[model samples]
Target: MKVRALAGVALLTTMTLTGSPATAGAPTTAAPAHPTAPQQATGLRAVADRAGLRIGTAVDMNALADDAPYRAAVAREFSTVTAENVMKWESTEPQRGVHDWAAADRLIDFARANRQKVRGHTLVWHNQNPAWVNERDLTPAQLRAVLRQHIIDEVTHFKGRVWHWDVVNEVFNDDGTWRDTIWLRNLGQGYVADAFRWAHQADPQAKLFLNDYNNEGVSAKSDAYYALVKQLKAAGVPVHGYGVQGHLAVQYGVPGDTLTNLRRFERLGLQTAFTEVDVRMPLPADPIKVQAQAQGFTALLQACLLADRCVSYTLWGFTDRYSWVPGVFDGEGSATPLDENLTPKPAYAALRDTLAIAAR
Candidate 1:
């Protein structure tokens, strides 16, 4: 899951409840000063529990296997997990019929062992696609068949294990037009509906979602999703959710009217989630920028809490050490609630405070 800002467009993009006090080790500068004994919630999972939402993070097989602390942190903090890439098209079916399930199976096994729900990262996406999919110029009918089969096989494989599936991801451009990916180029916009249908057929119990970034706010991208979701519901498409990837940057400022946008989707009888949230700042993160990042993080959680149908809040990854921001966005890192050393940052405290207040 390399989270990049939507290209060729600029777009702008939480909760409170109380529980036990947050743990110590949070940066004093980032943490709020307490008058009495500093009472803080235990962890994100605890905070989310107070607000009736699930807290999750993306995980990779390597991290689970190699990093003891990472695995412990994930198990301790999150109640749900999304595979960063194991379930993506490129990783699942690089050779078309020759499907691979090793990595995905490991993730599922780990989640089961840890008592965490699993969210299948994606069933369809333009990026990280296998070359074989495009290199062989198949007819519209052939490509459609291929797409349908892929969804059916993948969803069926994970069937009862997955709680949600990102049935289609990043399909719309920032300006509300469909991205001319292989799916759109060959199967047209019809592929979106078809993808959701196929996934639902394979596993009716699993929630199906259309996930994307740049739609966190009330913008053209979100408007496009709103119209698409309405049309899908009218046509009896089994679309279950809309995933607003909360990938923010302090420099760009938090998105406006996010709660309103999420509520509109909920009105369509669809569940909503902060699918992939991370607030990145430029390198050598100073107090001012870090504080701003904390504010941005708290705002997202607050918006989710305000939305009735927003069921889950998932960070892209929990710790900065494994964040995809630095690799993708030069000079930008520290995008998660935990720092590289797995220490809670100000954003973590802010989240705890927000959830605590919301619970009250």
Candidate 2:
């Protein structure tokens, strides 16, 4: 998830913080009444399978071991998995040259055991860097060497296990300017292309993606990605996909041009995905808010279904019990398909209905 300073007010402020699902609140005037019975709880993976796409969720290592029900739900509902944090630079290599694969390896093993594919969370990001990456004060050439080695070693370790790698994450500011992260400060914009290239060299079969939030619709941020992707494609950078982190808030309503935005990326011959979908609502979620959240989730799924090149829909997390929203944002949460008790919510049913229609 991309963590940035909160901006705007009401809807926009909520949107800036990141993503999740909803609960059973009062129905808004536009929303359909909550279904008394949410179908047969047909797993999302089954519905997605019928539509020729994958439904996935981010997983934490501790959840796999400590929460039997959560693990069961993951295997039962999702066809793909992404490590929430274990694959990031800070988690994988906390110290110089000392790689830690224990947590990440467990996720890959679990995915394989359940006949699911793994999407490596990230290979390069502006956040979650180990202290040494910046504290060492390395020269441009030295920093570039460090980045190349990190991508190569990490991608090589996973090899055939991962189906997709988020080669570069959240590289552009909301205004479309390149973010001045350590990578940009040290190696400039070329680092983005180099990161994708090195990852491809390490894992030829793995699909590479540039992942970010607030790019679910046509905007300055997404426009920046479009230009960069065009350049990368012309140069044969091996970028196979573009990720739209669908971290929405009901207060703002869904982005009207989400499908249009995704289709544009498809025209560039890149696969698009709702990489981190979660429709959060303000605290004390009323029925109106829940209904809106359900509508938001349905719209997003419909958008993905409409886009031929959109290959997957992945939630940041599935259940509200372990959601990352409340910890990060005050007076906001309940952004997942399942409530704290692991029962399917209105959003889950909305997703099912959308997938069912698409499957037909």
Candidate 3:
């Protein structure tokens, strides 16, 4: 959360086809006119139009904040933007004493002006905390209060704007054990409950999502989330969706059991979204490896498209230029399907092609 583009970076920054349209050229001043009726085939938008799907691109808030050209670049690739990093507690309230809403504000503003729907980054995550929220040695009760107030201030701060907020993030680890987050330590399990309640009070319309990475396949983490969601639903928490952050690796391959995991959650009547979707190839962009990675993207897209309640599918960030992979992954972070300067990579074209075929 709070993914910032290093200022002065050339700026920001796509793939896969389950039915995504092709963004073939540079995003232009004029959007093309739409056909009155649905086509058998076309690009990402077309696929969505015919099938009623949501295709989105994640973007950096700072890119939209002070940089016009960068903003234009992003506005070109995506019609829907998930504030890539902004909106988290750390970025918004880095110095605890001060509340810096300007960044998140601009992102929300950009999405609104563009007629783009936004997925609010997060509300309760152990990472990206304001220094002051936990700086002092507060007791469990005091910490609980901090958590509640944080949910209120943050949720109310952008009420009615964002369509969905990742209310709680990565609470379960790969092993199905609860992550040792400060929220867990101080506020106990009830914090998750209270976050949803406070968020509901702040903006009843905004859908609340429990977001996590690497839950694409049925694993311990997915099981843990599944159990927690059942409990939350039984307890009347306002959780409406699941954010399957698609940070998958090409080596492992998308598991066969993911469909089962997805179906189980949908049975609970919750919408699912492929939140931070990106499948990374192992290394030096070999053509073969790239092809496998492209296939991986196709697999992920297919999963989302087929899942009954999967509402949307979004690539984490569009191009290699702006991806967090290089910053986070050591070997070579060429997981993205778009190249620098935002050209349509093979992955992008392949997805568009898939969408076209589906429409037909």
| Candidate number of the best TM-score | 2
* Steric clashes per prediction: 25, 8, 12
Ranking by TM-score: 2, 1, 3
Error of 2 at 155 (Å): 0.3
Count clashing pairs, candidate 3: 12
- Off by more than 4 A, model 1: 1-41
CA lDDT scores, all candidates in order: 0.78, 0.79, 0.69
Sort order, lDDT high to low: 2, 1, 3
C-alpha lDDT of residue 228 in model 2: 96
**lDDT score, candidate 3:** 0.69
lDDT of 3 by residue, 245-321 (tens): 87766666656666567779999989998887776665677787777667666666666666788777788877777
Worst 10 residues of 3 by lDDT: 19-28
Question: What is the alpha-carbon lDDT of model 2 when measured against the actual structure?
Answer: 0.79
TM per candidate comes to 0.87, 0.89, 0.84
TM-score of 1: 0.87
User: Mind giving the per-residue lDDT tens digits that candidate 1 earns over 1-360?
Assistant: 111122222222432111110111111111111111211257777766666778899875677767777777777788899888778877788897998887788777767776779999788887776667773677778888888899899999999999999999888778899888888888888899989888989999999999988787778888999999999999999999999888888877876688888989999999999888888888889999889888888777777877778888888888988777777776878889999898999998887777666655
Q: 1 or 3: which has the higher lDDT?
A: 1
lDDT per residue, candidate 2, 22-84, as tens digits?
Answer: 111111111111121221246787877876778899876666667777777788788899888
